[model samples]
Each structure stands twice: as C-alpha cells, then as structure tokens.
Target: MGRELVIGDIHGSYKAVKQILERAAVTATDRLIFLGDYVDGWGQSPEVIDYLLQLKSQFDCVFIRGNHDDLLLRWLKTGEYTEEWFNHGGRLTMEHYERLPADKRQLHILFLESLQDYYLDDDNRLFVHAGFTSLNGVKHEFFTRMFFWDRTLWETALCLDKSIGHNDPLYPKRFTHYKEIFIGHTPVTRIGETVPVQKANIWNVDTGAAFKGPLTIMDTGTKEYWQSDPVHELYPDEKGRN
Candidate 1:
C-alpha cells in the first residue's frame, strides 16, 4: 500500500499547500487525508479548492469538514453572512466565489458539501478537522458541529499521561477508541510551534496557514513530516488573517 499522509488546514494558502505537497513527494498512489479549513483566509481560496478537486482525480483523498468551511456552505445556501464569519477572513472566500462563473461556483459548493466530518482507517487511525467531543466513534448527525469546533479533546489529551495504557481509567477517554487521532483547526502556532505537534496520541498538524505559519503534512506510520515556508512569506503583499 502507498503511504497514508495526513495534512492540516490549508485556509486558502494555495502556495503553502502546493509547496508541502511537493516537499512530501506526494504520488498518485499515496492516500491523502486533509483536515479541513480549506477556505477563508488568503487570496486563493477558489484556487485551493480547484487544485484539491484535481488532486482527488489522481489520489485517494479524504476531505474533512471544518468550521470555516461550514460558514462558507451556510452562506452559499442562504446568501447570508454572520458577522463573525465575515470578520474572520470569510470575505476573501466570498470574493473569490463571486468572481467565478455560476457553474464553477456551484461545483465548489458541492465539493464543500461533500466533505466528511471524520475518517477512520482500518488501522484505527482517526482523522478529523477538529476534535470531537465524544470518546465514542464519530456521531456524524448529532455532533457534526462539534467535530469542527471542539478543542477540549486536545486540551485533555495534552494534560493526560501518555504512558497510561488504554485500559487505565486514568487514560484519556477521548483517545480510547482509536490508535491515533490526527486533527487540525487548532493551529500549533498557538503553542508557539510552527510545525506539527504530538500530544499523547493526537497529532495536531495545523501550523496556522491562515496566519503567518507553515502548512504541515505528515506520514501516519513513520511520523515523518514536511512543511511549507511561513505562509506570510509566500504572499508577501497580502495582510492574511490579521
């Protein structure tokens, strides 16, 4: 089997995403699992989605839903924008879509609608855009929103003792169901790191592509990783998410 590669949020940093993919030497045979937040930050949200759609045609790809993506979908369906969404880089995404042809816009909307809340491989490696609230397997219908917004699961993981065995009650209940959990949405830059970070069994790969950090991608088995240059460097003229 090809390598199983898990990627963090892109947040419309198409240049960063492209650089990381090249650095990882991604092949058609590799399985790519993208943790969401694909849009709403940089100037290339539409281009990022376009590239992703092309990638799906060549690789085994799994796309996760994220809070920002949800906001985009909500606006696409209702033609309404919440203040929180517009203020947080959503305007850039809207501008990109508005410039596209009607058919192309619909295609991107469908792509966002088709994103999965989470993915679990046969090896018990779980991939989610954001942390899930329940220790149980993903409840897509009931906790879909949480899958894109929750952070407590990661905070709990960071506090728990990793040496504890799964059977131990002292072990984090949130991690009991999976061998490893890969996630994005909570950028590692918040902890002053610009690279993928591991806390217990959870791997946080988001290096804040929406802000001024790199984009990260990692091999699920070998724990090897690759990253783009700081996103700000890629688009020197843009203000990004400030």
Candidate 2:
C-alpha cells in the first residue's frame, strides 16, 4: 500500500490543485482523500471537477461532499438557488456548469451526487468536509447537514487542545473515538495560518484556496504537507469569492 494523503478544499482553483498534486508526487498506489469543496469560488469549477474525475480514474480516491458542493447538487436536481449559496461562491459554479454541454454537465452532477459525507479509513482516521457532531461513530441516520455545516465540533476540539473545559462533564465524547480527524470546510486562513492546523486530534486543512491562501495536502501517517503558491496569484484576474 502507498501513503495516505488527505487533501484540503480545491474551491475551483484547478491550478492550485495541480500544483499540490504534483508537489506531493501522488502515485497511483497512494490513497487520496479529498476533504471536499471542489467547486465554487474560482472561475474554473468545471475544469476542477473534470480534473477530479480524471484523477479518480488514476488513483485510489475518496471524495467528500462540502456545503458548496451540496448547493450545486441541489441546484442541479431542483433548479433552486439559495441567496446564501450564491453569495458564498455558488454563482461561479453555476456559470461554469451552464457553459458545459448538457451531457458533460449531467456527468459532473452525478459525480457530485455520488460524493460521501464522511470517510472512515481502516486506521481509524476520519475524513470529513466539515466536522461531525456525534463523538460516537457517525450514525447512518445522522442529518446530512451536520456533515458539512457543523462548527461546534471544531470548537470543542480546540477547547480540548488548549486543555480548556476538559473537566466539563458535558463535553461530547464522540470526538475521542477517532485516532485522528481531518476536515476542510473551515479554512485555517481565518486563524492566520496557510497550513494545516491541528487542534487536539482534529486537523483543519482548508487553507483558504477560495481566497488568498494556498491549497494544502498532507500525509496522514507522517503529518508532512505540501501547499500551492498563494491561489489568488494563480488566477490573477479573478476575484475568487472575496
């Protein structure tokens, strides 16, 4: 078996995605776990999805679904749009899809719809687009929303990392089940870091490719990582969801 790599959000920055993949020297034997948010933000959503699909054919890959990807899937299925999604980079995704041929668009939609909410590897590491609420194993009937929208789990993990409120009896026990957890919805850039941030056993790898930071990918076993150049520089003419 090859090394296991967990990647941060791509957010339509195909250039950054390409950069990280090349930098990591990903091989066909490597297991590539993408933390989601493959679309929106940048102008290359279609290209990004295409590349991911192509990458899937070449490597062992796990694709998780992010909130932005959920919105895109919903729009594809129902022709509905949420103002919030649009404001959060949905418009660019729509524009990219709209320009694609109908069959190609349908294929892309199917790919997005097939994404997993979370993935638990054999090593007990959990990969999710966003953190989950339950510390117990993620339930089959758990609300899909929590898979891509929960933040309190990260907060609790942060608290645990700082040894703050560890004595609080009410703290959730679910987080302790995994050997380590990797997530991407909440960007590390918000915390002034362009690299992966580890709070307790939870690793936040979304280094804000949607804005000004680099795209990140890490080796699950080694904790070693690689990042693209500042993503904004890769697409100099675009605003990129800012």
Candidate 3:
C-alpha cells in the first residue's frame, strides 16, 4: 500500500517544495495530497506550478483549489482583479506569469481549473485546502468558496475541549464525519508553532511556507514529517508575503 503524504501550503516556494520532498524520500508509489495555495507569496509561482504539473505525471497527486489559486484563475480568465488581490501576492505572481508563453499560461490556468475542492480517500480521510463548515460534512457544504476560505472549522477545533469524547453530544459533528481531516490555508505559525498542529481530529499541515516558516510534508499514517529550511532563507532576496 502506498503512503499518503499531506503537504502544506507552498505559496510559490518551489525551493522549499523541492527540499521537503527530497528529504521525505517520496517515491512514485506514494500518494501526495497537496493542500494548495501553490502560488502567491514567493516569486516562483510559475515555477511551483510547473513542478507540480511534472510531479503529477510521476506520482499519485491530489491538487486542491485554494483561495489564492481561485483568485489567480479569475484574473487569468477575465483580467479583472481586486486591488487587495494585487497587493497581496497577485502582482508578484502576475509578473512571473507574464513571462510565460500564451500556451504555457493557458496550461497553468487549466491545471488550476482541474483542482479539487476536497478529496475523501477510501479510508474516509478527508483532505482539503481549508476546512468545510456543513454539520453533515463536506458534501453538504453549500458554498464551494468556503472549502478554501473558511476558518471556522479550524477555530472550532482549536476551541474543542480535549476531554470531549467522540461519543459526546457536544463533540463537533463535522469532525465526526471523517476518520481524519487534513487541511492547510491557515498557517500554524499563527499559533506560534512552526510545525504541523493537531487539534481534535484535524491536522493542520500548513507550516507557513508563505511567510517565515518552512514547507512541510507529513505522512498521514505515521505522522512522521519533514520540513525544508524556512522559506525566507531559501529565497533570501524575497520578502515572501511577510
């Protein structure tokens, strides 16, 4: 059986991506579940996409859509963008992509279009860019945007009392729906930890590769993990959405 490795947000740090994958010794037989935010932050957005696309050809990979990814896709299709998006990492992402040939640019857009909002494996393990809010579970979620934008699920998990048993009526239902829930989107760095965090049944893999933290790849089975050096150190020349 192949190992399932859930990855944290890349945020365009292709260097960190490479480092962690190499350190993890990921084989073609392993399943790589990316939690998205592949772009936006570092200057290597285009490079990261290209690397992921190549990796897809070589291994079992699941790509989940992220808010920044959706934002970039919208601009790529319509050329309309909010000022907030531009200020945040869109401007830098655009600068690199502008150098892409039209055909290559379209390929990147198509890759983004093909991303999943969430994936449930045969084990009922749920992998998503962000958390879902529906009490019944992800399929019951009404807004696709919430898959990559919602923070409530993580917040609720954080607030969960460790003493609350699984059978407790007060236990979170959304968590009860799956054997394990893995997510990115919100950085664990926010809580001052530079590693993956486990709250309730949810594992937050996002170690803040977009800021000063390292990119992470964790084995879902063993919970063993590997990390690249801080993303900022990989690209000493860039501020990386800091």
Candidate 4:
C-alpha cells in the first residue's frame, strides 16, 4: 500500500508548504492528503493554490475543503466578493486573484468550488479541516469558527464524553474508538502535538508557518513527521498563539 501523509492548514504559505514537502521527501507513489484551509490568512494565496494544483498533477492528492475554503467557493460561485470575506483574510485571497489575469481568476475560482468537504480512509482514519458533526446533525461548533477550528474532538474523545457529539456521524464512533485521526487548523507550539492519552491517536500538525513558525507534515502509517520553519514572518503576533 502507498504511504499516506497528512498535512495541516496552510494559509497561503507557499514557501512553507514547499519546504515541508521537501523535508518529507514525498514520492509520486505516496498519497498526500491536505486537511484544507489552503488559502487565506497569509499572503501568496494564489501562489500556494498554484503549487497545490501542480502537486495534484504529480502525486495522489486529496484536498478537503475547510470552512474558509467553503466560504471562498460560495463567494466565487456568485461572483460576489463581500465585505465579510475581506475582513476575515478574504482580502488576501482577493488580492491573489486580482494579481492574476481575469481569465486565470475565473479558472481559479472554479477550482476552489470543486473541492470536497472531507477525505476518509478505510484504516479508521478521517481527515477534516475542522471538527466533525454533533449527534443532532449540527456541525461541530468549530465549523463556524474563523480559520481552522480547535482540536475539541480529540479532547472529547480523551475525556469519553458523549455530550461533545456533533451532528456528523463520522465523529461519534471514531471519537469513541482509537482511530488515528490527522487534522490541521489548530496551531501548536511544536511540530506535532499528540493528545497524551492512551494510544494518543490525534495529531495536530499546524506549526503556524503563516505566523512565523514552521509548516508540518506527517506520515500516518509510520508516525514520521517533517517540518520547515517560516521563510519570513507573515504575522508576528499570530504565531502559534492563534
């Protein structure tokens, strides 16, 4: 079977993504699953998307849409970029499209819309940009949170609390069982932070590259990880603190 690597949220840190891929030494035979939120927050949104598209051409890539990606896609579908989007890092994304020719912008917007919500594997692994559904079918609270959401699912699993349920059935059983879940969105001070529970299944790989930290990547089967420090500071205050 091919090796699978899960990557965390990349808020337009194209260089950081490149560096992490380099450090991981990803081969064409390997599968790289991105947890979404590929654009916004930092600059270089267009450049990052371009790189991801290029990677998709060479490697087996599964790009799941985070809330931000979903919102961006929704906006692009209407051809209406609103003020709410601009206020929450949408300005960077808008600038990315504006920098390109009109035709290219239209094409890119379509590309964003085609992304799916999540990627699942038979090996008891599920990759999402944020939390899963609650028992009532309501999305986890983090789905509405700006940017990537917290690792609350992991915490709830550790605590064995059913009240933490989301509307999404994907989360309930997995949370109860010890399945290795790879997610990005929540920033961590270290390259990889394991939930410190028995089996320690949850892995948080967002090293805050857009916020003056390193971008991270991890191999699910081997438990191996790689990271690359920020090429330059994008937002000093947001590093690992967000």
Name the best candidate (by lDDT): 3
Screening candidate 2 with a backbone cut-off below 3 angstroms (N, C-alpha, C), the clashing residue pairs are: 135-174, 135-175, 136-174
Every model's TM-score: 0.96, 0.95, 0.98, 0.76
Clashing residue pairs in candidate 4 (N, C-alpha, C atoms within 3 angstroms)? 133-166, 133-167, 133-168, 134-165, 134-166, 134-167, 134-168, 135-166, 137-167
Q: How high a TM-score does candidate 2 get?
A: 0.95
* Regions of candidate 3 where Cα sits further than 4 Å from its true position: none
> Per-prediction RMSD in angstroms?
1.4, 1.9, 0.7, 5.7
Residue pair clashes in candidate 1? none
For model 2, residues 191-217, the per-residue Cα lDDT tens digits are 788999988778999999999999999
Best by TM-score: 3
- Estimate every model's Cα lDDT from 0 to 1: 0.89, 0.88, 0.94, 0.66
Which model is ahead, 1 or 4, in terms of TM-score? 1
- The alpha-carbon lDDT assigned to residue 127 of candidate 3 equals 94
Which sections of candidate 4 miss by over 4 Å? 79-84, 136-151, 154-174, 189-200, 231-242
Model 1 has an lDDT value of 0.89
List the candidates ranked by TM-score, beginning with the highest: 3, 1, 2, 4
